[model samples]
Target: MWLKNLNTIFVVGYPIFVSIIWITGGLFSSFYRHRQSRKLLTADEEPFVSILIPAHNESDTLVAAVKSLAGLQYQHYEVVLIDDCSTDNTWELMETLAKQWAGQLAIHNLHLPINQGKASALNQGAKIAKGDYLVVIDADSLLQPDAVTQLMTTLLENPNYGAVTGKPIVRNRSTLLGRLQLLEYVAVIDLIKKAQAYLTGSITTVSGVIVAFRREALNEVGGWNPAVMTEDIDITWRMYRNKWQAAYEPRAVCWILVPERLRGLLKQRQRWSRGGLEVLITNRRGLYLNPWGQRGLLLESIVSNCWAILTAISLVAYAFQLFFLHNLSLDGNLLILMFTLNAIQFTIGFIASQEIAQLTLPELLLVPVYILYYWLINLVSCIAAISSYFVDPQRRGTWRSPDRGL
Candidate 1:
């Protein structure tokens, strides 16, 4: 009886509880941000921003990315294009662009002899960056005209904020998979960040696709850790440990491509999952010592990972019970409650993100599938990440161009 009750709580109650928290927190954050967006914010001073693009064989996307930066409304910025030892013509393209934009915009082209990784590339760029604020964007990213301005406004307003991450909007939605990912980005990723920032006052991780960092904060944290798989996640935690706040600015939007195919999506999720696990493992001591500080960000990470493991086990046990034991006791009401809560959360998310995401009516049809999609992906990736972490813990954090959707 005790075991059954525990199972029930894990299977039903836990998800409901988490859903409620996210819903309330997300709604509160959304409304607050909506109100804040109405106010006019003027920066007292224009700080020089170094836009860093770390590329490894990203020749196809680099030109478009640089072109996007050239249209930014913000002034006092330079582009630092770091070619991480690309075998292709990425270097040549960078040189050509550098010469073309020489008079218009300050373009610095740095090339690495050997492929160290994204983190290494960023560190190298930072050393040569002339800006007080550093904005890091992926090679495939297309920044909005005012993205840097918005990020800078938020960072400058909050003197304690060390970093601010922008929202990533999926640009390629031609395929069904891409559309589904677009929904995920709006409903799950963006919603969760809003809730996290509202509830905890600090986000778990900054979106690496588009994020701004203060030079002083980066210096204090000792820059990006080259050993970690996800430098973004690691740097956020490091800032937290060093008493620096991190923020999520939804207005600072960046258009990025998502993996359209299942294989590509799996590979991407696996890398993300593994990087998360790596961060947790590396910062176990700090988390242990300061479990409740920073609103228990590290503690929440540990809980979320454990929940994923238990969820996988629960599914297997349910299968075994139904097939072998022939005594599957499913709670219909509980399932309904879970579904309803998830629907409510997604609805709130959609409404909050509608302005920025420009969500369509057709995309709304995939809400049910979207919910189930994330659950399956999360479970599979978590299990794979755990396995990979134990098997190849010493794997170098390198870079590879991911599947840019059609």
Candidate 2:
């Protein structure tokens, strides 16, 4: 009876609980906006914003990225381009772009002598930035015309908002892996971010692709940490502990290229997993002694980690039980029920993303298969990341672009 009850909780009850959170959080994210006017602030009225684009071996995509920035409708902003010792001709391309958009766009170009990773590059950019707010954009991403303007408006409206991160929709879906990633982004990443925002008034991470931060809030937290695999996650936690708020703006859209092969995808996921584990370890103390309304987020993180471990153990136990009972069945009632609930979860995610990203019908159709694919990959990645965190003390927190699909 106890085993049956545990199976029900894991298979049905937990998913229902998760779905409720997702639905309400999605609604809040979709409709909840500041009471201020919807209009984008004009140049004379708004605060100056520094747009930082950090590049490394991005010659192939630099031109398009700069061109997208050039088309921005925001007036009071400057582009600070940091070339992080690219071996390719990225510097030359950046120089050309700087000259071409010289007067039309205020461009500051800096070249590092050696590749110091993204965190160091961003820190360098922040130090010299003149704007009250700093906007970080990856060189490989293309921001919408009003992306910067929207982010700034959102940040300025709330005095406590330390940072605001934009939505990153995958742009490269030419390959099968890419298509799978598209579904994962909309169904998993986006949903969780919205839910986190709604539940805690904070998010787990400010996406590295495109995020804006108030200069003072960043300075208070000592800028960005260089030792973590993900600077974004590290900074978010710092802001939280420092009593600053982080927000997610779904309307602020940035298109990003995703890895389109299995190897590249796995590497990206592993890097994310390692970064999360690093944050968990670093913040272990804070999780125990919560301060200044930080207990909710702290408890959430601890629970999430515990849940992952328990889920893994439960699956192994269930497998052994089935084998011992000689009652293994693929077409069981529990399997069908679980599948239906997952399908409902996917549909809710698809509809939410469609409302935000304008996704097409065909992309929505792929959610069922993509859900299973991503679950297995994510589980394996989490296990690998946990092992690395404990056993591999020599691992360097570095950044390298994943393989671009053919």
Candidate 3:
């Protein structure tokens, strides 16, 4: 009798324990690095920065997007908006913005005779970028006033920090969905990133909206390639392998629009998922038992991505216990306690993210219950990965933001 329910405990408890372990390690690591990141704020001789904006057809918000950057406190910078063969009036918009901010922003209005993709567009923009640092942002994103100054200052203080990412706040989060994203943004834009900072100071992904890297660093990797679906992630990994550490400065924030509708959300998530898989497949060697780079960061990435597989194994054991083992009567107290523990963990995440301004109160509270809603993203990503594995898109250089552009 005692042994009958033992299988259930073993099935669930182990994975839960493992998840806690992962979070705990990340949390402690983050706590330590938060201090280090803060110290990377020495008065910089505001480095020259070339802001890269690659758009397909972001006619709706491209002007406002450029306006945010045009007024950066750091006077030594240029905004280069690349037009990636848009059928819309996006090129016209870029032309207008270029002239309007003529001296301040050196607009690299590029229309690849054919639509190559964001990767190509960024490469094109980077080729002409004449700044000490290269900063990339999406068309729907806007930077904070001090964003440029903060980023350069951070790097100036931390010479070892090859790339520094700013915080991403969900802009136009007026709707329920938008509000949800705004709420969720805080956790991701801050806490988790903070955790990633200490674990290896080598985050696997960087927000395109606001990430600045040394020009030489990008040159070292030979620029963005179409092969890497998620050019941002690919670049981050490359920086790590090349012994370039990354830092996250939540103080430098950018407001970005989230996919307003479900369809848009799916497309956006699919792209991210597809890109993640592509990154993993291409850089698997660099991350796993590689001779180069810091060991801790590689280990963290491997564990995080491999968590899905680890969870799958536990679920399999749970299925067997319930069906074949006929262990229909598991202890209620144990189950309750285990779930409550998970609840506490989720609460901590909610509290952490919420306190850090990443998630809304409701989103944090609802994170567990919204399994069907959010889990679909994981499923879709898996699907995208499968699709990419078989039929790789024709080096489609342009990345269509989930809801915006062509």
- The number of the candidate with the highest TM-score is 1
State each model's CA lDDT, in order: 0.87, 0.79, 0.67
lDDT ranking, high to low: 1, 2, 3
Q: Across residues 1-406, which tens digit of lDDT does each residue of candidate 1 receive?
A: 8887687777677778878878888889978987874432344467889999999988889889999998988878999999999989999999999998888889999999989899999999999999989999999999998899889989988889999999999989899889888888887788888888998887889999999999999999999999988899989988888889999999899999899999999888988898888888777887656436454767766877887888888889889999999978878888899888988877887887787778877777888888788778888988888888999999878877669874
Runs of candidate 3 exceeding 4 Å displacement? 1-44, 103-108, 287-372, 390-397, 404-406
Q: Please give me the total number of clashing residue pairs in predicted model 1.
A: 0
For all predicted structures, in order, the TM-scores are 0.95, 0.90, 0.80
lDDT of 2 at 368: 70
Worst 10 residues of 3 by lDDT: 367-376
- Relative to the true structure, candidate 3 reaches a TM of 0.80
Candidate 2: give the clashing pairs.
none
lDDT of 2 at 24: 72
Candidate 2 per-residue lDDT over residues 259-305, each given as its tens digit: 87787878888888888878777777776564533565566656555
Considering lDDT, which of the candidate structures 1 and 3 is the better prediction for this target?
1
The clash count for each model shown is: 0, 0, 13
* TM-score for predicted model 2 compared with the true structure: 0.90
User: Which numbered prediction scores highest in lDDT against the true structure?
Assistant: 1
- Could you give candidate 3's per-residue lDDT for residues 1-406 as a string of tens digits? 5553555565446535544554564578556655653533333546677888888868987988888887777777777878888888998888788788887776767666667778888888888888879888888888878887777777767677778888887767656666655644653335456665654445658877788888887788777876666778878777776777777776677878887787777667767766766666666676555443345445554554454444455466668889999764545776565555555545555565454344555565555543234434555555655576568654444555347422
